[model samples]
Every structure is written in C-alpha cells, then in structure tokens.
Target: MLHDLGGLLFIALGLVLVAAGFVWQGGALRPLSTKRAQAAAMRDRSRNLLRSADMAIAEARRRAARDEPAIVTVEDVTRVACRHYGHLFVEREEAAAALRQRYEAADCRVDCMTDAFN
Candidate 1:
C-alpha cells in the first residue's frame, strides 16, 4: 500500500510539473508572438515603401527619356518617391517615434547609432 501511494504521488507530481511547464510556455510565447507580429508589420511597411520608390523611379526615368518640354529632375524624382510612399513612410516614422518615446519614458536605453547604421 505504501509503494502504491508513493507511485501515485510521483505521478501527481509529474502531472503538476507538466502543467506548470505548459503554462510557462504559454506565457513566454505570447510576447514572442506579439514581437513576431510587429516585425511582420514592419517588413510589410518597408516592402510597400520600396515598391513605391521603385514605381516612382521608373516613372521619373520614363518621363526624363520622353521627348517633352518638361524634363524630370532628381528633385522631381525624390518628390514623386516621397509622394508615392509618403503614407507608409509616415506610419513607420510614427511607430518608431512612439516606440522611442515609450522607451524613454520607461528609462530604457536604445542604441540609436546602431539603428541608424542599420
């Protein structure tokens, strides 16, 4: 009877440990999932910016090569690029600024130079 009780106790302990592990894993995964979603959003924003830039550059090149009185300049290209991608750029900048403000408010230090380098 004592041996049976000991075996039951071990099983219960094991089950408790397994449950605790799952709970811990769930808690840890939530933050990771959130970070992943943020990262995906950032990637999508960047892709949109690049696509807009590409379209603007192509349009500018086409305009420049055309036989027209108005020749497209570098400034015109830049303006067009900004106009095309302005929304995405502004959103990304806003998100970054908000993140920076939150980090500063929390007294968390960020490597700004490293971010600029990237």
Candidate 2:
C-alpha cells in the first residue's frame, strides 16, 4: 500500500510539472482577470510611467540649473528614473521621445539625451 501511494504521488507531481511546462510555453494560462480590472491596471502602469518620466525630466532640469555638464546623456536620465521610480517601468526611448517633443514645441534646439545614442 505504501508503494502504491508513492507511485500515485509521483504521478501527480509529474502531471503538475507537465502543466507548468505548458504554461511556460505560452499555453494561454494567462491571468483570468476581468477586462475592467486589466484596463485599470494598464492605466495605473501608464500613470507610473508618466510620473517616472516627469521625475527624470525634473532631474535633468536641476542638473541644467547646476550648469555642471550641459550634456544630459541617456545614462543620466535613466539613472535619475531608476533612482526615483526604479528601472522596470522606465523606458529610456519613450522618455527621450517625450523630451524631444516638449523641447521642440518651445522651438528650442537643446541636444536630447538620445542624441548620444544616435
């Protein structure tokens, strides 16, 4: 009876592992949350991204005021975002894009952080 129980336990564990493998391979075991919940979560994520972008931009402005290095490199902007809001949600490209738009809107020719990358 003990041997039979052990065999059954092994079989159960194997099935669990197989299911996990399928899920890992994109077997559509995605979070079964409501659409409204997913939308709200996406909105929150966007808000966090915006806030991080704003914080990074503000840091760039402070650095400008200091007249230290006139050059706001991508690394500098990324570091500022990571310092305040962590790096997971901070997209350097997106932040740079926003900065370019804002700067150009005011007819300014300031070199952007992404210019170094280009």
**Evaluated with TM-score, which candidate comes out highest?**
2
**Each model's C-alpha lDDT?**
0.48, 0.58
- Per-residue alpha-carbon lDDT of model 2 for 59-100, expressed as tens digits? 666666443433445455556556765655556676565445
Q: Which ranges in model 2 have alpha carbons more than 4 Å from their true place? A: 1-33, 65-118
In terms of lDDT, which candidate is strongest? 2
Each candidate structure's TM-score, on Cα atoms with residue i matched to residue i, is 0.34, 0.41
Worst 10 residues of 2 by lDDT: 108-117
Error of 1 at 53 (Å): 0.9
Q: Which digits, one per residue and each the tens of the lDDT, describe model 1 over residues 28-89?
A: 44355878999997887656544543443345445553443322233332354367656523
